[model samples]
Target: MQLSRFTDYTLRVLFYVAMNNDRLSTLNEIADFYGISVEHLRKVVHALAKSGYLKTFRGKHGGIRLNRTPEDINVGAVVLQAEGAEPLIDCSGLDCTLSGVCNLQRALADAQRAFMQELNRHSLADMLDNTAMKQRLIGKAV
Candidate 1:
């Protein structure tokens, strides 16, 4: 199963923010650091802010920061919010036209739940320790 670009970028943004810790990261800073489009990240940032993951400030020194601790930001919850719904293939509540009852929907739901349950076991804090992500983006973090 593939996730959307929006969800992908949102997770990237969260990782960068979690790494910065005390600093209030700017949209441009993250966009530049990740070499992503500022315009696209602006939308993602706004959505994250609205959803209570990050808080934004307006001023010369203004920027964004996580509203809660990284350990508190459950990956599963964030994925649900970013995806805007569960990634399940719902056939229908109605009886199937097929003679045999297909368990496709039920199977998909179970798989999706398992995926989320794994995510729920961790937080943004857990992901930030990823060495490859840090090295790819920050180059040894001077």
Candidate 2:
């Protein structure tokens, strides 16, 4: 299943913040690096903070940071939070005549579950294990 832009940005924000766990990271800095909108990241950050994945600070020296360690943050859990528990196919809203007879919904649901299971096998720390990627994302700072 394809993830929404919101989920994509959510992962981006987490990666940026986790890489810079030594200090707080500003929304503008992350947006500039990813060429994303600060306004959009603001919503993403707010949601992350509310969900306890990120901690935010205010005032002159304000920014964001991961509330928990990278190893403690499960990729599947993060994706689940950003994407929600919605089924892969929203058959409820569709008036499909084969709704009861079709096994497509079940198949899609199983696939979605398997996808999440695979993601659950890796943590944010596992993703960050690539030094080259870290260097590319945050230069030599990481």
Candidate 3:
């Protein structure tokens, strides 16, 4: 199934925060660092903050930081929340015409559940478990 840009950006933003660790990373800084659009990243940051994934502050020293440790942020939870919709296939619906006529709905639901269960097996920290790889992503030691 195709995931939305929101989920993609959520993962990227989480990785950026994980790379910075304790450093209070800002939207502008991350946008520049990744050469991405600051405006787009800001939306992702806002959603993350609203979901309790990140903490935000105001003023000259204001920035974002992880509300939980990288280990605590489950990849599946992040994706589920970031995507903001059930991973149901086109056949899924409360009153789906094919609900009882076809098996696709149940099959797709099972697959989606399996997908999330697999994702739950890993965390943001698991994405870059190696110190060298983590450093490479951040371009420095945290």
Give a tens-digit lDDT track for model 1, residues 41-84.
99999999999999999999998888989889999998888886
Summarize candidate 3's per-residue lDDT along 12-56 as a digit string, tens digits.
888888788677888888887667899999999999999898999
Candidate numbers sorted by TM-score from highest down: 2, 1, 3
User: Each candidate: what lDDT?
Assistant: 0.83, 0.91, 0.83
Q: Ten-residue segment with the worst summed lDDT in candidate 3?
A: 84-93
Screening candidate 1 with a backbone cut-off below 3 angstroms (N, C-alpha, C), the clashing residue pairs are none
- Write down the TM-score of every candidate: 0.85, 0.93, 0.84
Number of the predicted model whose TM-score against the real structure is largest: 2
Clashing pairs in 2: none
- Model 2: weakest 10-residue lDDT segment is 133-142
Best by lDDT: 2
Give the per-residue lDDT of model 2 (tens digit) for 71-106. Answer: 999999999999998888878878899988999889
